[model samples]
Target: MNLELTASNVYKSYNGNQVIRDCSYSFDMCDIYILTGPNGSGKSTFLRICALLENPDRGEIEYSSEQRVLKKDLELRRRITLVLPRVGVFNASVYRNISYGLAIRGIKGGDFREKVNRMIEFVGLRNKKDQNALTLSSGETQRLGIARALIIEPGILFLDEPTTSVDQANTGIIEDIILKMKEEHKTTVVVATHDKDQAKRLGDKVLMMNDGKIIPT
Candidate 1:
């Protein structure tokens, strides 16, 4: 199904200070959108609202297909995943960290093992499958976080500064995986980043924001 997400007249504030000022944008399925801006530009705040991680103070978020609106409920949320700027890992083995989501979702047995193994290899952590997640380097932890999110196969993926702390080598790997996701799973990806080059490489359409407003690109 072709999914569409729309945000209208979105506004958010913190302590009487507005951050996202009447921001509005729409995105369709299977496309990569890069929200690029300097720090405090409200890119991350906008992404968080769209990803349903944070609610907009005054706005409406609508999900639709074939011009029909779908209720924004738990089921809709299940189709979306967000990876924050700071990577969070379980204090467990790499294999366990990768498999935890599947397990919670009632996936088990051979199917579970196969999916977990595939993700570990896909993220280049096959050799560290049994290693503790906390012991992994920053790059490795970020990869693991991506793997964990991707294993669930969300229809929409939100990444906030995914390559912020990653090194040059791992940055390439992360970008590759994101492209692969768009091609194979048709995931709609929304990324908030500060790097213009990275945005050009991954974004089908790039939106520039400054001081809580999107500038014309």
Candidate 2:
């Protein structure tokens, strides 16, 4: 597999408090990595930098592979999607919410319906497809969040605490989808979590972070 993203000498600080310090890492295509650490360890911050959501204080972040190069933030963001835990969906119906990315990317008209419908069913939202998004329960909302992220068909998927505060059934559902992503699409997956069981089950490479640095395993 080719290298998808690389961060060299990365650093971040807020109010003079350093969150990520000289964090350097690289991810390859189709690699699934899990980030684990205690609270305030900057796991999410590192992920944000990789996702282009936050700029590092001092670092070079780049995305390149054999087939293409992501030279701009918008280009990179379009391919690198993030699904945050407890994410708030926009006020819309579930079907509309699932197709929101497609609309934004100018993928509209009758062509989008089949893709959106497939994603809705893939996330097991067939019954709730026409319901209001805000009325769904937390588990259902999480499913919708995952579906929204998948609708873009990102090359690299970053998940922050995906299973946090969710019940076992929902966790299983999310895990199933993730497995399919890895097997079918070969999407590079980076996940931050406190669940050791999940990490063991899903991570091909486990990364342990502490105080803004990754502890070498």
Candidate 3:
């Protein structure tokens, strides 16, 4: 497996309360890594660090490809998109919500439309594309959030408890889409969830975290 992302001796704290303690791990390219733990077990914090949303107090994260090296934070961010546990939909149409990331990245007109339409279709939200994003159900909103993330064409994806707010049908749909992403796009996925069933279903490797430490079981 290729080492797409690596963290070495990572430690973090908030007001002297240690959250992550000397944790180190590597994410392989095109593989699904599941971080399974109880609430407040530092899974999301670890993911935030990997996504570069938050800087580690002490650690080094490296990302690279075969021909190009992702050395800077900006380069890594472009390649890795993080979907938070709570879906925050913009007060806009579902189409806009799906196309927002591309719009911010200077993609407009037909290019953005093509990508957004494909993503909405992939997430099975094509019918709701014209509806207000904030008016969608929790499950639809989560699917919309995932579509938004996928529109960025990220090489690595970080999902924090992606199934929490979703219904069974949508959860199954999202699971299929994620499996397809791994098979087709070869995107490395790191998911943080306390759901053991989901971990077993999607994870190629499971990191069981507890009490601020990763138990390599």
Candidate 4:
């Protein structure tokens, strides 16, 4: 089912310092929204809030469909996923790591194996499917993280600095995978990045963040 995420008057603070200031936005289904800003501009924090991984100090984060709003329960949470800047990997094989998400959800069988294999190949990690995930280079690990997140087929994908540790080649490949998600899967993707060029290349709409507030781009 398609879901829309809306945030209103969001405010977040850590200690005496406020990180987010009255941020408000609506994320539509099947469109790519780029949240661009400098390193400490609260882009990643905003993404976490939108993904419901973090609660805002004062705001409303409503997940609703055209029919009605859904509760902020486990079911709603399962429909979204987030990938951080530094992707944590397991000591297990690439295949195993990619299959972990489905396994935890009690999903296994021929269908599960097929999805795992497809995702491994999708991120250009077919050759390394059997390699240990922890041994993967920075670029490959990032690809693995993307594959892991995509395997679950989250309705809304929040990618925070997906290419930060990746090289130029892998960066292009990751970008292509994201674009393909938009073109083929109709996943609602929100990416946090500091690169304006990348935002231009990938975003259906670009929103700038500064001083913990979203500015129109």
Candidate 5:
């Protein structure tokens, strides 16, 4: 499931305040891309537009694979995922939270349970599998959000400021998970971060955004 995302001359605005202006870039298959910028520089907005959670006022976000452009449909949306800075959680168990995506896709039973357990362990939450998700700490909650995203095994994963709200230790854990995701899953990853060091740590290619445009390398 190799995927390519191309944003051509994309523009977005809110209340006449332009956030992203004439931004364009391509996300190649199986590579980690980092969008680095200061807050209000439109990194989040660009990620949202590319993730299809929001549409651009001008220009298009096109997704394609195997040299053919794919239609913007439910199937395409399912192939990708976006984890925002503030992760939304269900008032359920850790297992339930991680299994939700697969469950909705009609995946269940022993095999499904096994997959969910693996994800729990992957996020270092195996010991808390039965705990209520809303009760977890901020760092653990972030890990759970990532676990939930990974359980679906998306072809493209968009992570927005993954470490912005976590402690140093949890940041390390999340970074490990992302690295392993690249090595094992080969999922194309797009991470938005304001930390220059973090961008260097995770990005195969660092895309710097300032004033709503990509700074060419």
Candidate 6:
């Protein structure tokens, strides 16, 4: 089932200062999209609205599958995941951090252990599986965040400047993981970035933004 997410005439403002202005776009399932722009251009805000992390001050966001509209609810939100620029991790072990979501959803025992272990290895953190998440470097922490987000197999993934604080080596790894998710899991990806090279490398389609509006590429 191919899902589609659409936003129409979206507008957002903070402290009475307009951030996103009349933005509209549609995203289809299993494709990678890049939202590129400069600082304060509203890329993150726009992505948040689409990911259902924030509501638009004006306009509507709709989800549909096979041309039939679906309700926007907790279930729908569960299918979409967002990874912010700053990496957030639990104070516990890397194993616990990645397994938290799975455990919440009732996965346990051998099934739970397998999933957690696989994800840890996939993110190149197997050697650090028992290490405290807070002790990880920026790159390792970012990888952990990606592993956590992907463990649940979200239908749509929103990455807001995910590599902004990452080193070049880790940036390449993150980019590869993003591509791998799209190709293997068929997870629809929406990435907001300022790096033109990264956009070209990973984006199936690019949407350029400026001053809270999407500009023609």
lDDT string for model 3 (1-217, tens) is: 2338878888899999999988887777888888999999999998998888888899787777774557766656777888898888999999998998898888878877888899999889989999999999887887888889988888888999999967898788878877887887777888888989988888888999886667755
Against the true structure, what is each candidate's TM-score?
0.95, 0.95, 0.93, 0.97, 0.98, 0.96
- Writing each residue's lDDT as its tens digit, candidate 1 over 20-110 gives 9988788888999998999999998888888788899998888887888988888788777888888788889999999887987899899
Candidate 6's residue-wise lDDT over 1-217, tens digit each?
4468988999999999999999888888899999999999999999889888899999999988888888988778777889888867889999999998888788889988988898898889999999999999898888899899989888788888989878999999999999988888888999999999999999999999999988646
Better of 4 and 6 by TM-score: 4
Give the Cα error of residue 162 in candidate 5, in Å.
0.7
Candidate 2 residues lying further than 4 Å off, grouped into runs, are 1-3, 67-69
Model 4 ranges with Cα > 4 A deviation: none
**In model 2, which range of ten residues has the least summed lDDT?**
67-76
lDDT of 4: 0.91
Check candidate 6 and list the clashing pairs.
Answer: none
Q: Cα RMSD to native, each candidate?
A: 1.3, 1.6, 1.9, 0.9, 0.8, 1.2
The runs of at least 3 residues in candidate 1 whose Cα sits more than 4 Å from the true structure, single-residue gaps closed, are none
Residue pairs with backbone atoms closer than 3 Å in model 4 (clashes)? none
TM-score for predicted model 6 compared with the true structure? 0.96
Candidate 3: worst-modelled 10 consecutive residues by lDDT: 67-76
lDDT of 2 by residue, 1-217 (tens): 3338878999999999999999888888897899999989998999888888888999888888795666856756788888888777888899999999899999977789999999999889999998999998878888898889888888888999988888899999988888888897778889998788898988999999999998745
For candidate 5, what is the TM-score? 0.98
lDDT of 4 by residue, 43-160 (tens): 9889899888889999999989886999999988888999888888988999999999899899979999999999998889999999999999888998899899989889899999
Alpha carbon lDDT at 122, candidate 1: 86
TM-score for model 3? 0.93
Instruction: Please list all clashing residue pairs in model 5, or write none if there are none.
Output: none
Instruction: Tell me the whole-model lDDT of each prediction, alpha carbons only.
Output: 0.88, 0.87, 0.84, 0.91, 0.92, 0.89
Q: How many backbone clashes does candidate 1 have?
A: 0
Clashing pairs in 1: none
